[model samples]
Target: MSDVTVPPAPEGLPYVSVVVPVHNDTARLRLCLQALAAQDYPADRFEVWVVDNNSDDDPRPALPEDERFQLLRERRRGSYAARNRALPHARGEVFAFTDSDCLPHPDWLSSGVRALLREPRPDAVGGAIRIFFDHGTVPTSGPEHFEAINEFRQRKYVEEWSFAATANLFVDAPVLSRLGGFDATLQSGGDLDFGTRLGRAGGRLIYDDDTVVDHPARSTWRELGRKTVRVANGIADRSAHLGRRDALARAVNEGSGAVTIWLKVWRRNEPAPRRAVEKVRYAAAFAYVRLLRTGVHLGRFTRGR
Candidate 1:
């Protein structure tokens, strides 16, 4: 997308309310706030609502002195619930969602807003999620390599699956309102439900590769394992609501996906010893995750409506 220089008048530009949800992550929240402060978008044209999702540590200190960054709190347990808490307070015509763990590019807001205002306007925009490692270290771990390659494919998610992770998504305020905001009950995959609802409602959604944010990849089995459970639970949780047939099909499909785990590692160009070890590690992790998912699906099935 070409650079559409912001006109001198603040009123002419898109007024965006950037909403972020934080848990017990004050350390990364500080970085997220700092990045938001440094955005190329006109400071006056955008406001950020960082909802402290019941953090044990006080994140208020991470809040900038500027009034543009409002600090709010939600007693809710899930991120989507916390996001719903900010809906009533959003003042922007557009709402941009990112996680506290992300470092949004300086042009993130501008590129997203610009894309939203294009000639054939889309009701929502899903941007690129660039994954990075901690401290610029050499990508050593198998979990890291697998996650870096597989995680956060926002464009593919938007085009094929009809949703983008909240880690980097921009949707119009009215469209969000029309859909009744995100599903607060979900432990994960609220973005999937919301985006799917948007498409079903005839809303236009598009992908803008330039609109990007850097998300840290899960480097350990522990971290990625938690994500796996959440993702599995999220998928089953949503699918269960659709009925037993759909839920069973989803479980089978995910179970079948285990075969592709080998392909991901095999496709990578790496040294032999390292590749072999990585493949084993990836297989182990995938199996562990599949086990967790299977358990969750069984529980959901047992508790069927």
Candidate 2:
């Protein structure tokens, strides 16, 4: 997208700065804003920053003209790029990040801020995420869906294995500035890379089980494919940057493992077999592209013209 740049922090700091990066999804974006507005935290203590990532849709009409919210648009393509655009404008001691589609519980801000504040200068803190789905249209309690959603819940909150997603993570300005902010080059794995760097730099990462947000699963086959492709590209880009042979191998193995689990679900049970099969096929194709991209990326990296 664009080169990574960090601007000077705003003059005065607030209690917490909530940043939500949005593209063109106005409807879902509105829902997320509504959830934030309903937060239990005192409205005067927190400010919301919405970064519009080059949306073709004119979002002004969708947004209510208000002083509490600031809408900034970046012409860049990636969410990380847009995050950089908004980072300079943040005036909170701790910056809380979430996607436009994610909905937070009323206590999300209070709990998350408390988690970060309670720690002895932790670099970042992450909360739990639950999938929210439309009732009757799809069963949220389905085994496959529930398992996928609960995967994060089952993870140990140990410091050694501490990794946080940007969707539910809060970071201090010092750590963010030290880490040079999220890598704008990464398509999807920037969050993991940032966490890894923070870990390497002796930055403490914590997981707070009490803090939670609702992230929705992809509802349609098209969205599932799009997400898979982006994820594969991220793996390829990450492997290339690291210049490690095993990185690509691990990506392939993990990608295949996902396929195998989906296949078992499709063959053994899913009520919608056709849709399941289609998703599996799309995932396989995405995995194959990742493999191919790895090869091409390695070649370019090695040549280094």
Clashing pairs in 1: none
Off by over 4 Å in 1: 1-11, 135-138, 242-274, 302-305
Give me candidate 2's TM-score against the actual structure: 0.75
lDDT of 2 by residue, 89-179 (tens): 8777678988888888899988887888773757788888776555543434333343243234513533445678788888887788888
Task: Give the Cα lDDT of each candidate.
Answer: 0.82, 0.69
Report the C-alpha lDDT of model 1 over 1-305, residue by residue, as the tens digit. 11233234545777788999999999999999999999999887888999988888999988899999998788878999998888888778789999999999999999999999997989999999988886485445666766765678898898999888899889988788889999999999898888889989999888999999998888888988888888888777667668766666656666665666556546646322255776677666665666667667766766772
What TM-score does structure 1 among the candidates reach?
0.88
Q: Report lDDT (Cα) of residue 124, candidate 1.
A: 93
After superposition, candidate 2 runs with Cα above 4 Å error: 1-14, 136-161, 241-305
lDDT of 1: 0.82
Candidate 2 residue 194 Cα shift, in angstroms, is 0.7
